[model samples]
Target: FAAVVGSVQDGGLPHAGCRCDNCQRAWADPAARAYVVSLALVDARGEQAAVYLIDATPDIKFQLEMVGEWLGPHPQRPQRINQPAAIFLTHAHMGHVAGLSQLSFESMAVQNLPVYGSVKLVGMLQETELWRPLVSQLDLLPIADEQTIVLAEGLSITPIGVPHRDEWGTGTYGFKIDGPAKSLFYMPDIDSLAQWAAAETVLNSVDVALVDAAFYDAGELRGRAAVRHASIHDTLAFWEKIDSQLVLTHFNHTNPLLNPAAPERAAVQAAGATLAETGMVFALD
Candidate 1:
């Protein structure tokens, strides 16, 4: 099963230094707050469950707590929660990689934890002096594009390269997780569907696709420079003919779909797409 630990975009619901209406609601109510986008894949077929985290978001601490049961207790320190078996990074974005700092000497202090990312992404981490110490504490593995890594008997993950903003020249990846009886595709960040030539084919091939829904429309940008994330309106239109379950996620603070009462939420539902919520679980079998 795959557990959604967080559903909001990088900065999360109550974005820093922003007093937007949505941020205001989240600030006023704890229940309304959300963390950055992340997913926990759990395989409990054996005596000991295998848990893998996709994207180590800035909200990793709380996100780990959400999956504490599956992680179980720490092996060395019984009082603390066990670290995930591995972490698969999607890109070099702040929300996707910031949580690594928490796992360093100052905090979790995880040892030899396998962290997978693109060759360039891993290189960037290994070359940075600030992260050198943390890098030594981890088993950094560079993954090739479209390479399938088998985690267990029937659980495997393939990191498919996707078009997105890559300032550091490190590519973005959308993970395709194949479980015993089902497959899921997770791409929390993408520049645009039109830019990806294989977008339709790949999305339709999966049982469920948790895609980027960062904004409702261009208008939400408020005349700012164009962003890389795809808008909800464009995503819905692109997946109109697809049969796979289109689960929208990675919402920005300004996105109207975040509001339960917003008509855009109903519109999305009417279009046969559902919104991604934290703690939502998807069965693999």
Candidate 2:
């Protein structure tokens, strides 16, 4: 099963120092807090299931705990850390790679685990003085665009290049994960639907597509320039005819869809696209 571990955008719900309505409500209620977006794929066909994390979000500690059953107990060390089989990073964004520090000697001290990312991403992680020691424990495998990596006999992942906010020109990827029984397309941070020529074809090919839904409308931006992410309304319109199950995720704190009663949420559901939530699972065929 591929689980949706966390669903809020980079900063997560109740974003730091913001007093927006949603943020304020989240601050007042523990139930309202949402972690940064991340996904986990668990292969439970064997005695010990192998777990792979899609992104090492800032909330990775809690996200790991959420999948403790699959991770099981540490084999040789004390039971303080439950490690995933590997970590695949899509980019170098703070929210996406922040939790990498947790694996350092100061924290979990995971040993010799596989960490996959672009060439530049792996180089940056290894060359950065602050992360050098911790990353030394990781086997950084640089993945090329469109290259397929086999996880198991019937499961594989391919990195699909996509356009996004590339600060250092390090490419961004939207993974195409093919499982035994079904396929999944994860495009958590694309700039816009118009930018990708293969968007429709790719969405039509997958069983489920968890896409970028960082904003609900342009109003959320106030007078500031709109960033790279696409609004939910835009996604709904463009993906309305796709055969795959369109699941919206990576929500910014200001997005109205976070409110259960909000019309935005209703609109998405009525249009047949599901909203991603923590712990939501999709069985791979």
> In model 1, where is the ten-residue run with the lowest total lDDT?
219-228
Candidate 1's residue-wise lDDT over 1-285, tens digit each?
998999999999899998898999999998889999999999988887878999999999999988888889998899999999999999999999999999999999999999999999999999999899999889999999999999999889999999998899999999999999999999999989889988988998999999999988887867534577887778888887677999999999888888889898898899899789998999998
Clash-forming residue pairs, model 1: none
TM-score of each: 0.98, 0.97
Q: Point out where model 2 deviates above 4 Å.
A: 223-226
Compared to the true structure, candidate 2 yields what TM-score? Answer: 0.97
The top-ranked prediction according to lDDT is 1
Per-model CA lDDT versus the true structure: 0.92, 0.89
In model 2, what lDDT does residue 114 have? Answer: 97
